[model samples]
Target: MRYLTRGLFWIAVYLGLALFPCLALLSGNMPPGYGYWWDFSLALGYGSASMMAIMFFLTARFKRPALPFGVDVIYYFHKYIALLLFLIVAAHPAILLATEPVVREMLKPAQINRYMAAGVVSFLLLTLIVVSSLWRKQLNIPYDTWRLIHALLAIAAFILALIHIEGAGYYINTPGKRLIWPLIMVCWLLIQLYVRLIRPLRLLSTPYRVKEVIKESDEVYTLVVEPRQHEIPAYKPGQFAWLTMFYSPFSMKEHPFSFSSNPEQKGELRFTIKELGDFTKRIKEAGPGQTVYIDGPYGAFTIDRHPAERGSVFIAGGIGIAPLRSMLRALADRKDQRPHILFFADKSLEKMTFYEELKALPDQLNLQVVFLPQHPPANWPGETGYLNREILTRHLPAHLSELDYFICGPAPLMDMAEKELHAMGVPLQNLHSELFDFV
Candidate 1:
């Protein structure tokens, strides 16, 4: 409840920031209207710029403000909002071009001015951002390259929009209004500083040394690390961190991975990563004594967040089992007596990460392991084929509404489980998931 309150407070603050610029423009001496459409276009322009500035704060990893909704959730919201906000931005010019003959003339090479050019370029950059992000995989753009491009384009668009607005000199004509506008822009600049400059600098102070790397399965490897100069940051079992290694913190080459080891142990940390991306493909090359900088302990997909009154259930597909391993290990260390059930979907027993430990976990805690291998060997006793509604009904216990359920893995699997479980009488609040695809 406290987290929810704080979350609501931050949202209110965001609303104020987004709406303040429009209010400032209107609060000043009013200018004679050219028409309703012309004034409406200007209003859209101001609102879109204000929203663009706020984008930095959304992705800044404001850990406390993001407690009620996880950073993962915010990242997804950022994606959604970016798309919506871009439409507003596009409408600003579009409405003007359609309704105002003067706007069309200004775009001509003969009449184009610096201010008009800025607005044009800003809109183009915003278009690029949306296209690159929404279809990154289809475009075959490298992840790090795309991030650098995205940040640079975003900053340029915001600054250009501000320049275009200030140059036009429409509504914010009074001295006080002019002063307030610059201050708001400056505040937005500070947020950008913290996100791109200051935060990375802070991460440099704390570092970890890679202890060893162990291949957990055919497609997964666990990288073990211990704190080098400072104590390990306290973290919940199903949390993740952004790791920068083999490259400077300024490189923007960081990737997020869940804590696969037991959080109860403080001496060392472990991250079990799959060979899926450019970063993870190189995990096998990470040797001992390499420096690593971690920037998190974020996400809200842990059993520790709520009291599991009627036990818990975990549904995992492929690499999604990393965070669940952390929770299971923590429960074993604490000697938790509540009933626990795990439905792990994988290709085969040999391909599953932590196969040995999972088989051994039932003895330490009140846990049951149910493997759903897609390709089972002859005479295999466990369930085979993909995880779907029928298999879920067969394994899941009665009174589903009372138990807490954590589902992670591929996007499709999570989507299916979330929908199916909710339809099967599970309350929305009882289901939790970690969405790494957004990250």
Candidate 2:
């Protein structure tokens, strides 16, 4: 069923691209002073090229796996095609001007037109988005701020391009062609509106009020929120949710924080967040009675989906301990006596997100927590340094190959863990990982 859905998605994507050119070619009317046959061919190629660019951006945002292939490969293909489409679309005006003298006249200041203006605006916006994204770190623009700007600019570019196409009356001459682009724009707009606005408003009614804030460390703070309404949905151990504070969806600045408390306990939902970025850094100042909106429970990084007979190993680092803690607490509440080992890595013991809560879990659950510190304290007895192959082999169960490993951490740490596991002969299927960042 999953394969079938993916296949249909790709088919629809290809069909959408094909339809753009087909519509332009079969318009049955050419722009003034251009040969009908020539105009039809040019319009067909231009439309297909534009649609290809659109598809590349859309697919990159919402990744879908292809049959017998990895999602990573599809993403690379999308990147390459996007670059190709940019070149094709960029040369379109030059080609038209060279072939049709009428287009050259339209480019003149006296004949300055809406289509030409929109085309220019679209190109500029695309250039800004692509360039800023590619060099975001080098340019020193933060991810959150860049994301907001990127979304706004993308919407503006799409609107301008759509108006250009409709107002030009060349390819979109017929009533059908005119209706198609507007309908597509309206549908796209509505989806964004629902995802960004409508759904968040619904969450406002069933609020989760902040009950308490526990300061685990200088930077790490754990927030306990109790539902004011009747019932809050019980999520799986490792699942995450989008949390919004102070009723501002336009703040649209929601972050995905893992649940640190047990899911079984409906008394209060706890989230242990580290002061990392602009949004999270402010979490320390949040007090009791503050209203928060949670739009989740998303992500598939839990033990509920995959039951193992042998045991489970959770490898986490820094703030990555949020989900792992939730899993531990949930298991303890259920009294499921399964052997679980937690390999938590951090710069220092003081920076650990949830130290006390983790220590208390062993009494109620069958678990062992191993903290790996880069710089251990004067008389620290726990493991030190990074989580390399030696550290994993020492702490891991004897039947490591039979165990299911769940790893969550920084990109570099996660990569190292996966490599070490693979070197130790763990099957790829048995190893699961979740990346926090979308990029």
Candidate 3:
């Protein structure tokens, strides 16, 4: 209920920001309406620009704004909101082109004004951002290069949009009306200041050094780090952080990973990473005493968030077990005797990342470990293939609907498990999943 209030508050704040400029258009001494469709299109242009401006704030990683909704949830919002605003922005001009014949004349290469060209270029840049982001892998654009390009293009598109607006001198013709945009410009510049310069400078002052790298299994490794300047801040068991190892924090090449170690142990952080790609594969080369920058501990997929009077259920696949391991280890360290169950899915017995440690954990806490190895030996007695409704029901506590479910893994597994659990009467709020593939 408290989270709901915070969530609603943030939503209200977001709506207020998105609608502020549009609302200002209704203020004192307004311009005469050109036409219904024409004025409506202009309103959309103002609203879309304001929404785009706020996107910078949304992705700034501000802890307070992100706490109500987890960082992952906020990012998902950012992606969808970008999609919605793109359509609105495109519609803003489409309506004008259709309703005002003068707009069609402005598009000719021989007679386009500078302001019209600015608007056209801004729209093109925005389209490129959307297309490249959605099909980045298909187009084979490098992720780090995309990040840098995404930032620069978004900034340029927004500035050009502001130019397009001010140069027209339509609604914001008067001095009082013109004041609003300068205010927005100040806010935009401040956001850029914090994201590009101030935050990176702060991260530079407090660096974390790699303590060691432990090989977890065939392809997974745990890179441990301890702060050089001061102890790291406390974070929930299943929280995650963005680590910059090879480059400075300003490089924009950092990768996000879950906290594999329990926060019960102070002054150290562990990230269990898989050799999945170029950025992660570099973890194998991380040596002791290497300097690294951390920018998080943001997420909401922990056992600590929900009450587990009758215990809880955890579902993981492959390296998704990272956050679950943190929760289990933290619970064991605290000696929580409540009944807890884990359904871990992997390729085979040898391929499970935390096979031995999970097997050993039941002795320390009242925990049930269910391993679903895809390829089994001769007469495997345990579950296999994938997590389904039957597997969940067979092992889940009798009070199925009362327990909290924490699931993280491949998209297919998480999607299936969430659907199956909800169908089997688990409350929607009782099921928690974090979508961290931020590509």
lDDT of 3: 0.91
Superposed on all Cα atoms, the candidates' RMSDs to the truth, in angstroms, are 1.4, 5.0, 1.1
Ranking by lDDT: 3, 1, 2
**Of the candidates numbered 1 and 3, which has the greater TM-score value?**
3
| lDDT scores of the candidates, listed in order | 0.88, 0.74, 0.91
Better of 1 and 3 by lDDT: 3
Candidate 2 segments whose C-alpha is farther than 4 A from its true place:
1-112, 142-144, 167-174, 397-402
Candidate 3 residue-wise lDDT, 305-404, digit = tens: 8866888898999999999999999999999988999999999988898899999999999999999999977699999999898898899877899999
Pairs in steric clash, model 1 = none
Q: Enumerate clash totals for all models, in the order shown.
A: 0, 0, 0
Tell me the tens digit of each residue's lDDT in model 2 across 212-259. Answer: 988888888899998887488878898777798854755766777888
Instruction: Compute each candidate's TM-score over C-alphas.
Output: 0.97, 0.79, 0.98
Give the candidate order by descending TM-score: 3, 1, 2
Candidate 3 Cα errors over 4 Å, as ranges: none
Decide which is better by lDDT, 1 or 2. Answer: 1
Q: What is candidate 1's lDDT per residue for 99-181, written digit by digit as tens?
A: 98988998999899998898899999999999999999899998899999999999898889888887874787788877765
